[model samples]
Target: MRVAVVVMETSHHRDTEGRRHIERLAATLNEAGHEVSVFCAQWWGGNASRFEPDEVTYRGVTVEPAETSFCTRLPALLAKYRPDVVHAFPTPSSVLRAANAGAKLARAPLVVEWFGDHEESVSARAIGTANQFVTPSELVQTELWEAGADSDLTTVIPESIDMDLVRDVVPAEEVDVVYAHPLDDSANIESLFLGLAELRQKGWSATVIGDGPERDTYERAAADLRIDDRVDFVGSCDRERRLAIYKGAQVFVQTAWREHFATELLWALACGCIAVVEYQAESSAHELVEHRDRAFRVTTPQEIADSIVASADMDRRTVDESLAEYDHAAVVEQYEALYERLVDEYGLF
Candidate 1:
């Protein structure tokens, strides 16, 4: 099957979970013997020079960059590519609308993936335009349904991890506590700092990963809390380093106030880290580790600290079985099945 993936950006444009998700899907589809093409914008984060306007093969997938004014370019590209199915990410309204028009022009079935927590009212038109809807979490599906999407057409396909990259290299009890998230305001870094401060007195150490605008502020807070030595702020490393941290971490701490889908938390769990997520209405992290023995859902900084301490003795192997459904191969197979069904049903010959 020839598949055309439409998204605003990819990992080439920015290193984000959503873009990485698209890249993984495209790569996996190509590896499965399908011809996959990615239609995306050239300029992401004002770095147009980084990507050429011409088409290029990236990781076994053909990537065709479009103009900033994608509305005009997308339909033509779609018509020329003539893919059997067009999979689009619902974001940046313009891109979604463009993909919708392009899919119609190409006479291909449109599948819109609702990956982020977008307002249903604002996204209703895009959701309605697509032939099928795909979401990584039930929370997103619920939002789409409430926004007037056909519940029968919407499917929940969780984001998956490459199991080959995730393995228990170190026992959980022998590893240190680790927290990884952008040091932005939404991350609620203060809570983690407070919790770590308390844990430091008990002779515990933590490694804080990721970088953002608020890094200095968080660093100062760590200094003020007198736990600066106990905390290591190793900002923004590559994937290999990040995975190594997860593999060796005893407890993976998530202090974010909200998350549509906590990809980092899922990675840590798959790497055999005891997960602890701060309870939030919008967070889907809890869904991944429903078993209390594998995770702890807490409400306060104190509780987070306590949970981390308790995780020192819990067996990390308990969470290993829960991650099987999220394996990369399994998720890719589900997507392939969905594509085949949609293509046959729509008769996109």
Candidate 2:
């Protein structure tokens, strides 16, 4: 199938987890024997591979950037590269935008893919443009429903990670936890600091991976919490190095306030770290725990510390098995089938 993926920026632009997820999906679709193209936002700086004003090739696909939101530039994009099916990302905006873009450009089916609640508001124009809506997990699907979507509008899909980077590494006994994400708003780093302070009282050390605007917030929180000496925020890490960091840790922690499907959590699980997720009712982290027993969840500072302490006794092989369900190949097959079904049903080219 010739597919056009609509996304907002990528890791090629800035160090963002959402961007990385989009890149990973595009790469996977490319590997799954589809002729893929990406339409994304242009990152202003941060050393993205130099390309044309509007379109450029990054990784394997042709990535086109629209200057404004969907309203202005989409028609111009549709006039350029026509695709068979549309795979949209970054929640409601890109999905809505791509739906309009597809209407003008190609006679193709549209699948709206939401990474999280960032796309909470989908208008009639957006839904009218696409036939299929996919979310990373049931929790996200539920959110979509709550946001006035028609019943059964969303299908839950697991977010896949590159298992190659996660395999065969000796987890560092010295690193008790790995916090790999940009320390920012939705990440809820304050909760992490509070949890770590509690953990530190019991003699735990952690390595904070990734960088963002909120780094100083965490830096201060760590010190104010009196756990600064026990924490290390390593800037941005490459895939292998990040996985190596995960493999070396005894536990992997995510305190994000929101999540659709956390690829890094899957990486941590593949590496055999007991996954400690901060809980919220409308979160994929909770749904993932329901699907896999290897992960533990809690909301309060005490709950995290208790879960962390209890997780030290969990088996490694079991964690490895839990991560097996989310391998890219398995998830891609589901996507391909969905694509085929959508195309067949809608008579998309």
| Residue-wise C-alpha lDDT for candidate 2, range 222-287, written one tens digit per residue | 899888898888888887777777777888888877666776777787877777888865456666
Q: Quick one: best lDDT, which candidate?
A: 1
* Candidate 2 Cα errors over 4 Å, as ranges: 7-20, 39-82, 90-105, 117-121, 168-173, 199-201, 315-319
Per-residue lDDT of model 1, residues 1-349, tens digit only: 8888887566666566667677677777777677887777554344332332223332211233443466677777787788889888776666778887888788889998777654323456666788898888887778778878899999989888777766634333334688888878877878878887777658787888899999999899999999888788899877767778777678888878767788888878887788888877777777776774678888889999899888877764413655777887888889888988988888845
lDDT of 2 at 145: 73
Task: Please provide TM-scores, in order, for all candidate models, with all chains considered together.
Answer: 0.84, 0.79
lDDT of 1: 0.75
Most accurate candidate by TM-score:
1
